[model samples]
Target chain A: MKSDMSTIVKTVTDFLFGFIIIFGIYIIIHGHLTPGGGFQGGAVVASGFALLFVAFARTFLDKKPQQLYGLFESVGLLIFISLAFLGIYRTFFYNFLANSGGLFGMKITQGINPGYFNTAGVVPLMNMAVGFEVACGLSLIVYLLYRGVIEEGEDGE
Target chain B: MKTAYAVIFMSILVVFLFTAITTLHPMGYPGHTEMDDYFIKNAQIEVGANNVVTSIVFDYRGFDTLGEATVLFTAVISVVALLRGVKKDEE
Candidate 1:
């Protein structure tokens, strides 16, 4: 009979999901200058979304969310690949954005200093793209599984 | 007899896993290093990314990440294909 968690769990999930997602975005954006990257950050974000799924399991049957998840996943993959393809004039994955003095492009001083956000060329963009792709991809998987399992349960009932 | 066999199998597996973990080098210092040294030294300048692991994963070895994405995509596709026929009303 129970589909969703207790109210306390729902309240905690509501409070934590936003922060979890924000932290994931931070990890993705700071990937070039920090310890984590797109995959790790995206996984973090997807975990947050997964928590949301668990908190409201009964309401996920709507097909719209699943379609949206698929759309986002496809878009992420497309962007990542296109970005890679953009550097084809030089190489497959060339750092075309480095030192260009444009968006996400700034000259880096030799040796280590306080890291600049704009110094890492195409890395940030790739990180963002991969992060989006991974987040959506993982969210889709979890949502689909939830749907499948829940539907199976309903059939039995 | 079944319990004895299960225990013996589990103990052997545990012993193997324990040896694998214990044999690993302590944190920070790894067993082999020429590649790691090069990457650490050059990734900053080469890829302009401070995180060497990220630089290596996304820049140097981008194909691997692409493959990973493909794998995930394939998984999603298969999941959708399998579940598409299940009607919402029927359930």
Candidate 2:
């Protein structure tokens, strides 16, 4: 038996889910240029996922999404490490791409100015990697706990 | 009495903490600003990142972020180990 919430919760969750996710991505991608960073953005995204779980509990009865969350977290971590390794030519964690005139190598403006997307070298990449890891990891944590609670409730009944 | 001794100890500790806080350098008047100046001046040119904090975090001090990520990874792994046993029990 799959138990879910009412129509109002379902409607609200559906409406806000996409916005919350987009906000998270926005925070992560603009981390180098803005005030917020990867962790903050990831937490926001995870909270959106949690909101979905809450509003429509039965929707996540399947374990496949939970597993996918874990896998996505691992992939994020791998990408982060690979990016760090790419800077090995000079030293560990060196900014090799800066000023190289390639991807993410825009000449940084000194003072306040409108920032460009294809700048900041590995900062945005690292931000995305960390955002992916944190969002997936936290969502997975919430799902696992929720699953445990549901199981315990079933056992008692 | 024991109550008197406890009060004295607490007062002394509070006084010591207060004194330490009072002795700390005033805001924006630190004992050392050389490193701060260097990062602010050079972060953009050297790191090519507009946000100095990001460059300092992901480039100049990447190891710190790595350590933080490791800690998070460990926490997730521990949670999985604990919760996964429940599913395994049925299998």
Cα deviation of B53, candidate 1, in Å: 1.1
Q: What is candidate 2's lDDT per residue for A2-60, written digit by digit as tens?
A: 48778898999999999999999999999888777778899999999999888777768
Per residue, candidate 1 scores C-alpha lDDT tens digits across A31-113 of 99999988899999999989988888877655348788889889888988998999999989887887788887777766877
Which residue pairs in model 2 clash with each other? Answer: none
Candidate 2 structure, TM-score to reference: 0.91
| Residue B43, model 2, lDDT | 88
Q: Considering only N, C-alpha and C atoms within 3 Å, which residue pairs clash in candidate 1?
A: none
RMSD of each: 4.8, 2.2
* Position A134, candidate 2: lDDT: 91
Among these predictions, the greatest DockQ belongs to 2
Best by lDDT: 1
Q: What DockQ do you compute for every candidate structure? A: 0.52, 0.71
Runs with alpha carbons beyond 4 Å of true place in candidate 1: A1-3, B1-34, B88-91
